[model samples]
Target: MDWRTKLLNPKQKARQDYKSLVTPVYRGSTVVFDEQSLIKDDWKQSENGYSYGLYGTPTALELGARICDIEGAKHTFIVPGGQSAIALVYFAFCKSGSHALVPHSAYGPNKAMAEGLLRDLGIEVESYDPLIGKDIKKLIRKNTSLIWCESPGSVTMEIQDVPAIVKAAHEKGVPVALDNTYAAGVLFDAFKYGVDVSIQALTKYIGGHSDILLGSVSVRDDSVYNVIGSIYMQLGLAVSPDDCSLALRGLQTLAIRLEQLEKATFQIALKLSEIDIIENVYHPALTSCPGHEIWKRDFTGSASVFSFTFAKKISGDQVEKFINSLNIFKIGLSWGGVTSLAVVYPDLVRPNKDFEGRLVRLNIGLEATNDLINDLEIAISKIN
Candidate 1:
């Protein structure tokens, strides 16, 4: 009934002569059925029965089951990457001429997909402020079909009032999808907070080792699952068996790794907040964080990713100099891996008229907190 029992039972079923404790990576395109009748029966419902490797394998199914347990969902669909998972949600839910709403501070690529591709497809997308809370009601239209959200909006780290949004969306018969890659369900359970579809980039925290690229969408409602799964099959987007194996291995350590990372990050963010050069620390766990109340009320814990802003006295080039001085923190885009990463604010952020601070995103890894703090201090000292 609990996660441990479910995970352990699946391991028992995993081992046969051909299968092992960790389901042997099933790599093949064709799946030979017992007979034509069986094949036809399987084709009717690809998710329940395997017609081909592309549909899914026993290996992928085992991992999917595990994810479904963690997410508390009736069904889950695995995709190639986080972005692809997001795309699938839109494709499945949004029809031409329908409008979708996304948070203004969502991931840049997600915004681009809405503004460029979805816009081209004639789906209207309006970006609302992440801090809008219950005010999101005013933005909903008669044609609105989907409302997408990302808690602690990727760049500015403003945690949205998810419950408020979910309630408002459902009243108008709209489903809410959350880009939960940042929280990764380890900290927050989207289902408990009224989210219909919980989207995650298994490439990040789920694939904590960063060895494979995978994405997942966990749906609590059966009707939502059927629609998304139909789109998944139509789109031909399924994760490979080997990638699923790697992600399964990564999930086992996710709880421990995330706890350590969260603790270290809080310490680091607290120290960063004290630095005279930083105007604000955007970690939701800290009291100084703008969305601390919402985060405290909604989230179970925190993730390693957090952001901070530079004081106005610091120039963009000075910020770059500080980032360049870091010895341990690597300059990179992706996060939730074992290694810590840092991305300069100007490189990733486009200055918006609404936001005031120069943002620097940090992905704290499983590193010694003292060493990381020392490295950050040296980097911060160079910014002036």
Candidate 2:
């Protein structure tokens, strides 16, 4: 019962090789070593070994492993949020005087970063047409360092020809990175289509609960992984073990969730397209969307997120009224959760694109199909 005895507990206490269904949440800054020589001066955030807490804990590594498995990537690294994953790819491979070709329809913040951060750093971040496909080769220069794509591009729902773009980039010795958040790495195959780096906003689909903020970078080649991981470590990007555990749990149900989402979303998109209130629907599987053939050819399935347009004559006030009337679909930013979200982007990225009127994006979640449709119908009726 002495205090000395209590303080003398051995660091290597054996729990008789206990096993559990879930990866253990290891929360600690200091990893104790048995001997001094075991600790190396030059440590790395590697799959085979442990370095420091800022690099990653076992729990985070496990989540990374799960993502890499789904993505068919050779290595995976976790970041604080989805944008960090995007920025990681940029900071990793790009330097002053280099150029990055990004899809015009990519996530809005990514566009902002390209303009603000990358541009200021002397890297020319050019917005390439999402449907450019192999034509991207023409835009590539000797200083080209990266190509970024977002399938069924955020809000607008234009499907990029990822494979063709990848082919073009690789032939020019440039690496390509994609924001796979919409597909959630389930409906689409990034690596199979020759994407160099796959970035997932784990905050959306992977968290599935709208409670966690995390992101992951999955790479097929070790050299690519090393370039990304080294910058990842130097930047001191570390995710909470608790958040990583939540993401891991989200992985367990991702398949079924995606299946239900695809089914419900397609039906809703079909109904929306036919409605008199809608000007156009932008679902990749739907004919109204651009690059439908490319989507059908490369993607394994569809996702719940899509967008639609109202008649150009419709006033902004009317649009606001319709959205405010919705009960089931809440006004929010970000998608891929159990609850549906409705958001409207006033200014289109390329206002000249074949779009008319106000654009509204919908993230169809795990709600009853009839109820969600009814909510939309009632709101549309009010607007009319």
Candidate 3:
């Protein structure tokens, strides 16, 4: 063989038995089989064995498996990001002429997809109140195929009655999908509450450091798994194994991070509630949040993200001034990292109420509770 032939050889000369506490990043596009008869492409790699890297490399599968174990799902699929997970579920369950129900308070991008891509595809996704609960049955039509719930919903922080919604959907043979990112899959037992499909933006909590973009779709049973898996393969939603490796590392510290974040956030929320200028603090653990009792019943714990509203007398411009005044709490979006963040929704929309730009959402990080409170206090003083 020529020197070029030796350089291109696939054989491993070094000992391959190295073991480590961390998952190694597996990067490759092709999978080799000893026999041509064994060559095939399948997405059920967990059962059928690895046939192609497009399905997922071992590192991605391992992250999915760990999420499955924590969320108590039958199977889990890893995708590029949370929005991708939402897209996968939408494509899997809702087809042309199919009707679906989604909370108006769902992640912003989720609603955007419903109105944009899903609408253009001939699928109609109707928005419902996050507090609809068992009354959701009233909205189901003969063509209804899917229902979506997002507990402690994006920005507004409404904790939904998921079990009631699940029961209502199941009676009509419709499936329920949840955006379980806020709970980080572990805080809320999605499968236990009868949620058919539970999806998360691992970019937030499971990534823990906000450095990686990843998502997971976990199913309650094999029937749901097959439905999602088929679409997953067709869409070719490939993820970086390097991101998976980071998420795998994130899992190791998730419990401790959640513990600290919960404490710090709850403390800050309590302090905010006492301020006369703050009309509401929408943390799921507090009674000010819609469906607080449901959150206590369904979730094991509360997470870092929550929203608050300024007094009606305060204008949107003042809210922006307050946000800019903060020293430690950075102005940004997304949550569940080590850095605290604040953002104001000047144009937030719901069914009957108008925020008038007084609504602000905060993501509490692992910073000192007192320090965070002081940051908010100083900002509030500046605005006044």
Best by lDDT: 3
Q: Model 3: which ten-residue window has the lowest total lDDT?
A: 3-12
Candidate whose TM-score is highest: 3
Candidate 3, residues 109-147, lDDT tens digits: the string is 999999999999999999999999899999999999999
Candidate 3, residue 291: CA error in Å?
0.5
lDDT of 1 by residue, 1-384 (tens): 788898856645644576446667778778777777766433224345677666677667777788889989888777888999999999999989999999878888899999999999999999998888988889999999999999988867889999999999999989999999988865788999999999999999999977899999889888998888878878888678889999989988998998898899999999998888788888999876767899999998999899888887877778888888999999998899998899865755433643233678899998899999999998887766
- RMSD of every candidate to native, in Å, equals 7.2, 2.0, 0.9
What candidate 3 gets wrong by more than 4 Å, as runs, is 10-12
Each prediction's number of clashing residue pairs: 0, 0, 0
Q: Give stretches of model 1 more than 4 Å off.
A: 1-19, 41-47, 347-357
- Tell me how candidate 3 scores on lDDT: 0.94
Say which prediction, candidate 1 or candidate 2, comes out ahead on lDDT: 2
Query: TM-score per candidate, in order?
Result: 0.92, 0.95, 0.99
lDDT of 1: 0.85
Error of 1 at 12 (Å): 26
Residues 1-384, candidate 2: write the lDDT tens digits.
576776776556677677889888889777766788777433354645675788888898889888988889998889999999999999998999999888889898999999998888998899988989899999999999999999988888788888889898999999999999988986889999999999999999889989999999999797997898779877988789999999999999998999999999999999999887688899999989999998899888998889988987787778878898999999997799999999877656484664433888999999999999999999999987
lDDT of each candidate versus the true structure: 0.85, 0.88, 0.94
Order of candidates by TM-score, top first?
Answer: 3, 2, 1
